[model samples]
Target: MTVSAGSRTLEVKVLSAEGLTVDRKPVTKNVFVEIRAETLNCSTTSLGVADGARGSPSWNETLMVEIPPYARSITFDVKCKTSMGTKSVGIARIALSDFLGGIVPESSLQFLSYRLRNWEGRRNGIINFSVRVKSAMAPKYEPSVPVPMPALADRGSCGSQMRVPSGEQHNPRGVVTGIPVWWTNHSANP
Candidate 1:
């Protein structure tokens, strides 16, 4: 399906994260953020893991995402890489309405914060960010005319249609009347 010109693109900046906890202990280092959208197309983040400097991690990264008119929300998955494996610290779901509520002007930056939820549905931390919806060009409507299809050839009778070689014969219902070539070959060999 073709996207209309009225579709918007979003600019999301992940500023920082704070007050994170994993297994009841403060997460002071080795954390990374994974950003994704409800639509399968757009998701991005800072390239490498952000090391917490003096126990505070600041990503301050910017991502430009194409927000189709049908998209509803974007999700953030915060994880920490450890010796064992990556552990889920928290997740945040930000609605598109938060930025496109019609109260804010197009292409204006708005900073916001959301409470992060862990795997067990417990509060884990807070993520700070800014979002802006890029202005879209007005849609141009054009008149559409349907094209006519070509006519097919008429096959009056099944016997008049093209037939394959061998003893097989096709009836009016298009079913073969004679035995198949495989059975005839086996019977002849036996």
Candidate 2:
């Protein structure tokens, strides 16, 4: 449950899952990790590096995530691994949920539930990490504003360019232009 800043990416590593139980039974064994990441304006990508020695190792696998151009934030889930004398299994209750909540919006919390269900009876040696991103287009109620008239101006020989005012500006019709009128301290509120 630790996150560090990497070069142009994030290094998220799962410390360990505490108080693990199986079928209403307390179990004790070495538990690994399955990390999943989902963000806005991007698809879910699984991260891992190839290594002969299994288990968990620091610097073994660095979750190098590139910040999406339009992404504001991301969310992820961590599932712990269990061993049964020779078979490694992924228990549903052994998973924990955490998110980097910001301006980004995820698809739904239900998806995490679905992933936990997938490991019901399967004891796969490999830890499964499912990562998904909710694009900025998920919002359906965003209202559009009218383009300002003053923003439009001729560039001489090339073509006419349109500029829109942003925030607020003096308009006789009480219309808030979308173009940015000022970059410094200037309030258009009236």
How many residue pairs collide in each prediction?
A: 0, 13
Worst 10 residues of 2 by lDDT: 133-142
- Writing each residue's lDDT as its tens digit, candidate 2 over 54-110 gives 323112233444443233434333233345342223434322223323233333322
lDDT of 1 by residue, 72-185 (tens): 788888888778998989999887777775568767889999999998899998888888865554343332333333332332212222223222132212222332121122
Each candidate structure's TM-score, on Cα atoms with residue i matched to residue i, is 0.63, 0.28
Off-target runs (Cα >4 Å) in candidate 1 are 1-6, 47-54, 135-190
Cα lDDT of all candidates, in order?
0.66, 0.32
Q: In terms of TM-score, how similar is model 2 to the real structure?
A: 0.28
- What is the alpha-carbon lDDT for the whole of candidate 2? 0.32
Candidate 2 steric clashes = 13
